[model samples]
Target: MRPAAAGTTRLLCLAGVVTAVGLLPWLSGRNPALTVLRARSAEQEPTREALDAVRRDLGLGAGPLHLLGDWAGGLLRGDLGTSWVSHTEVGPSVAAGLQVSLGLMGAALAVALLPAAALVAPVLVRGRGSAGAGAAMLAAVPEFLLATVALLVCGVWLGWLPTSGWQGPEHLVLPAVALGVPAGGLLGRLVADALPAVLDERWVELWRGAGVSRARVAWAALRRVVPPLVPQFGMAAVGLTGGAVAVETVFAVPGIGRTALGAAKSQDLPLLQGSVLALLLLGLVAGVAAAFTRRALLGPALRDASLTLPTARPVRTHPAIPLTLFTLLAVTIGWGLLRDPYAVHTTARLAAPSWAHPLGTDGLGRDVLARLGHGAASTVGTATAVCLLSLLVALALGFLPGVAAGAADIANALPPVIVGILVAAAAGPGTGGAALAVALISWPPLAAHAAALVQEVRSSGFLTAQRALGAPRSWILTRHVLPSVAAPVARHALLRLPGIALALASLGFLGLGAQPPAPEWGLLLDESRAYVERAPWAALAPAVALALLAGLAVSGAAYAQGRAAYDQGRRTVASAVRKEAPVGI
Candidate 1:
């Protein structure tokens, strides 16, 4: 297809996806007014007539198709529908939210780039070791935790910045820093990846040999890096749409994220649907535009990743450790689901660990074991769901021909915290929200990985054989490409477990995970913080769970990297063995 035609088709597809996304409230039985009125009806044993009246009054009778038609019809007339909360035209609110969100994203990106550039510069000289590792670690920290710590240390302790609300420049500082720190860390790695190639250029060597200052060399290297970096950042910028929810909410930024969040909470269907659709389109367009802009600036060089940089070494981690962690996670989840956390044990109130009360009790005289058990189910379950869901989405994208790279770029750039928050806002606080959020944000990296694997496999000798033999593309792909890529994708998923775990925890910690009484570890931490002095185990129990989850995640990532190195060496030796084998055995 022609480029413009293809672009138009893709836009149409994305519009359809957006419309489908807007219909989720119906798909999941999450209609806000329906949920609320249902609860009231249950309390009063409401009549069928009264229930129907309530549904009609709250505008809950419309199906997803009808809602979409209404939304599109309103758009044709330049109306953004109306807000249920204030009964005002949503265009004004959406516009205001857009301004805030855009400003926040811009500031956050600006703050992130400076630090990332600094971090990347050192790696160009040092090679990939300390600088790269440190940056990667920092990037792994969830934005919600980053924001919380910043608030505690900077706002409460130091009185440096406002903890909440978009009042002025000062208000934006903390949120930007919270969001930017991880982004900068991510960008730094990309810069590190891109830098070595620039430094390897003949011109760079000649400049250095001619005694051109290190500053000049660095500047030249940076200029080369920027083109590749711009496209990557474009993807990241779009990913920020879902991920910005926590940043906006934590800081009360009054941005589109926060507005949409409220709309989701209240089940203000028209407002929520319109606002989310607009923001999503905006992010997607900006990212695609920025990436293409680089193509315009640097031509084919910026477009072809292989020409710009080498394949990234696959990250490795301890395969056995993740299994162990997964087992423990499973146990906790199973136990939690079977037990009641809120059942008070009057005699064992605030009791220390014993045969009956293994983990100990809390300040409220509740059984600590029950609560911990409950939390384990939610926390681990949420993490597992996030991990698997992300992989599935990635797999789907990778199955597509050319879309994987762009999709992956955007996904990688997104913060899981932002995604978790957005999902929580739309789906409400539960497994569905956290899992969907993590899954959405996690797709980019996996998609990118899958795309690369597909590209590599497409050129393999076996595939060439199949093609030459006139085997169908589907048969070749099913029998060849899928098998070759499966192991690596599985390993990548293991490598990503820690990130998924952290995101789940971060969301729960911010009261955006499983709601009250659901034993979510992050929620436990939040709930037990007040009782830390009285019953340390209540807090310590959840803290330890989180730490273990994090450790397991880290181990998996590190192990994946080590395994990649090991496998590469083994392949080299095997290749040598085959080369030296007698003809036809």
Candidate 2:
């Protein structure tokens, strides 16, 4: 057999084995009733005998092989058995939750994408630096923070929208906007960056020189750019799935997130596992769709590009800004460490800021300031790690075939709560466990982005030219393609960091994150719920910290995108000028 075929077979076997191993515990945790029902009548003697007979009759009594066969058959038929926690049919409950989640997600995408497209159009047309900066600022804000602010302003203060519950369209607006804003900002930057390249293409210039109107050129450029965005749009849709948990919880929506959160807290293994599996399946479907769409849009060119290396862009050294930003970030970190956030000691009814208890105490007698500080650190750290890990996994998987890449995307598209549940079940709940869970959930989008970047870079003239040269494939890929794609990929990765962090913190807040005594921000919020009326600051402090951390991480990503655009702009102008030179004698 060919080496490639052998590799493919090996990978398939590995995937099957890993999946089976991962699901073993969940299967073992199913209801005893279902296990007994599938057994032989002859073994039914006394109650204990009947139980043993049932186990034997079904594959469970026979051996590992029988159990595996039964499990595989059940999985193939989508008979996930009953949810151990909810005591309902796993499939139906998941289906119901999925409907609500998808509805909210669809609305969010509409709100986010349309406005982003409109906002980015002018930037793409003018190639303005300010436009990029604006996009960055918008993208930098975290969704949960945005949701909280929206709740206060639109729901509480103005009463323009409902603060909680999925009553109707009005309730969705606040949460959807909160979710869409960050996504819109990121998408705006992407569209803006992509447009300039298409606008400055040789064909565009050639058409322009032939007396085509600026409008025509712009329209044509947009047409070309639109097709490449299908995969991106699908990827965005998938990523949004992970955010649904926070959005649903914040809005008090009756969705899968709330269900999963409740299940996790109760240690309802079957319900949690079923929810996770459903989420994974949803993400996989989206990813597969995206992969097919990418292929359809790019045609045979993408396959050719995949096999080739990318080329390097000229790197311009920018001085001092990175250092200055780093310094500012450090100061913020220091401030978080030193400052007291919570006010009013509900536990003691003591006055604020005495020498004995500088930051006072919470209703539970916990050190408010210390908890807040630690919570901030933990929240930021966990989120950042999850986002980074997810990105790395996604990038690794993205280089595979379209089908495999799509599978990664599908995994990314699964709901964050579901992912959280799976991770918690698979690894158990803790810092390490949460991070791993986040990574597993976040991998699909990162993979999609990496794949898209690879496609974009592969088609560039520099890469093609490099290939035509006598350069070895490995040397060219390392020296050229990797460098060219690194900055943009890094920017994409950074942009995702805040969102993941917010989601993790939200999960924690809902009591699905770090177990007690971990000092996580989410746990702090949950702890503060009883005393919210007496000491709102107890909850408010951690909430605000979560928002700010998300904002800063997002800002960093936006800044990176802006710098990348500026650099790309300069290269395009230089290339245009070179092409316009007169012929030598």
Candidate 3:
């Protein structure tokens, strides 16, 4: 954990990313010269002389290793090379996109603090803090879904702001709010959940007893509550920009996320690499900032106090929420399945909803309801498979630590969109590619959680006693270690399913997954974009379904977490009673 070692690790990771980006042309199993030639002049013949000329022009004649070295060297010299598609300097475009993205993210961060502040305001005024259920629910909604709804409600319905394009201040409002609201809700929920525990601490009691002002105590509590959340905030930073892929695409904001997606689609390696590098750096900088902020907030005294920062408990919600969501989704799917999704009536394209077509028809006149039902299996089912695979990978890597931890730390900085781009380059775009991309980035959170829990469990007195009694590592792990870790980690993974689905949807939206006529939610949204103004119903069905699915995941996870806690509490009480009971009794 020394500063020097950290710096070296970061440098190596940067080099690795650059190298990988450089080799993407080779990894993709496609002719780079032909791709570049097609991008430059699609009508040209693919002759040996022309291919050789293109290869020479791109410096690919020197081999991949040299190209990688050239890329690394250029990066070191503050050069981003030139785009094959546009034949322009990639640096300027990357910089412009990054500037816009940074500005958007900054505004979004400010907006995020609003809800966090709102959550804390009551605690400052009153004595206790409540983790608002609304905040938790809001946090569960995906950025793309939120962006779609914001566009529908604010732009299309209310006509308060422009729906798309990055023209002026007006365009920023919807995207910022779309990105910020969920983030704010998450931040507020984390702070609020941790606040009660911090306020109940002995130090807070002593401070209040000493006649400290309520404002000062609340401020202190906030400080204590937030340091532990630096990691979450760091991830949130990544989410704001990385999640911006869909948001940017939706709003037509020329941010780095959109740039990356476009570059991937066009096979513009230079542009794609530059955009990905920018995003990767953003994540790294956010992590550094989080660490620095955590230290600054703690100061020397508190940093040395060995304080165990309060962990936020999951938000408890009424069981009815999940039940209602599940029922609604089930009914919708069941009703849709009875209809044919692929039946195209050219005359009825973009038609309004009728008894025959409950959710209306898409641009191809394909039944929206049927597509929704059919798409569920492709989107949700794929997400479930990805989540399960991620869980298994997390378990394997988490307990192993060492190299796994180091690799996770590096990969944690990678956005799912960036991973999708790389995966698509290597394995072509499809549902499988999107699933693989999501699975690649999804395991880090679970792995980190499991790793931390494993470390804690391994060091416990009970584990020590079991070890002293000659218990095998496998036996101990299965009997004690896994039992303690599995439930919490599984619950964590469950809460993340919606995000996984969203990522897949984002990929599909970017044309990196589930091609035409697929009926995948993201792809459906993409297809509906052109005729959305004429018939908004084409877009509404999939957007609403995605949002509803997110809500279901959140509420379901909350219900399960609450039930587990209740069961644990009951067992604890029963154990205590048994311990205190008389021998005869």
Q: What is the TM-score of each candidate against the true structure?
A: 0.77, 0.69, 0.92
Candidate lDDT values, in order:
0.69, 0.62, 0.83
lDDT for 532 (candidate 2): 53
Give lDDT tens digits, candidate 2, residues 1-585.
334643564456446534644354444444343333432233545476655654443334445565556555776898766654344687787778878888887788778886688776785568432234456557656565567667665776577877888778878888788888777776766666566656656887799789988788777766676566766667666667666766777778777766666555454545655666655555667767876876776677664454211121222223354455456545555654675444334556522545654444667566666666666677777777776676666556545546445354234455565656665654556666666656765765566677677777778888788889877888977787667666666667776766677667766765557877766777776666555546656666666666555545545554565577687899999999889988771
Candidate 3 lDDT tens digits, 1-585 = 434554566568666776788777656665767878887888999999999998788777777777778888998899989998789999999999999998888888888999878876776567675666677778877787788878887898889999988888888999999889888888887778778878888999999999999889988887778887887888788777677787898899999999998887777888988998888889889888887888887888777665566655556889999899889988998887788889999999888999888888998889999999988877889989998998888887777666456666677788777888888776778899999988987897898888888899999999999999999999998999999988788878877887788779888877889998898998998888888778899899988888788788778877887787889889999999999999999
Which candidate should be chosen as best, given TM-score against the real structure? 3
427 Cα displacement, candidate 3 (Å): 3.0
Q: Using TM-score, rank the candidates from best to worst.
A: 3, 1, 2
Q: Candidate 3: global Cα-lDDT?
A: 0.83
- CA lDDT of 300 in candidate 1? 69
Q: lDDT-based ranking, best first?
A: 3, 1, 2
Between candidates 2 and 3, the TM-score winner: 3
Candidate 1, 1-585: lDDT as tens digits: 334543554556566456665554554445565554644454754567766776676556888787667667777898877665566888988889989988988898898988787887666665443343446566666665566557666876688888888878999999999888878877786777567656776888899899998887887777777775776677666656655776787667898877777776666666776677667667668776886777776776546653354445444444776688778866765665566688876776678777666778776666666787777655655677667776777767676635555444344444555455446545566766777777766776777688678889998897898899999998987888887776688778867766676777767776666777666777777776565545667766776666556556656676667676788899999999999999997
lDDT of 3 at 171: 88
Q: Which candidate is the best by lDDT?
A: 3
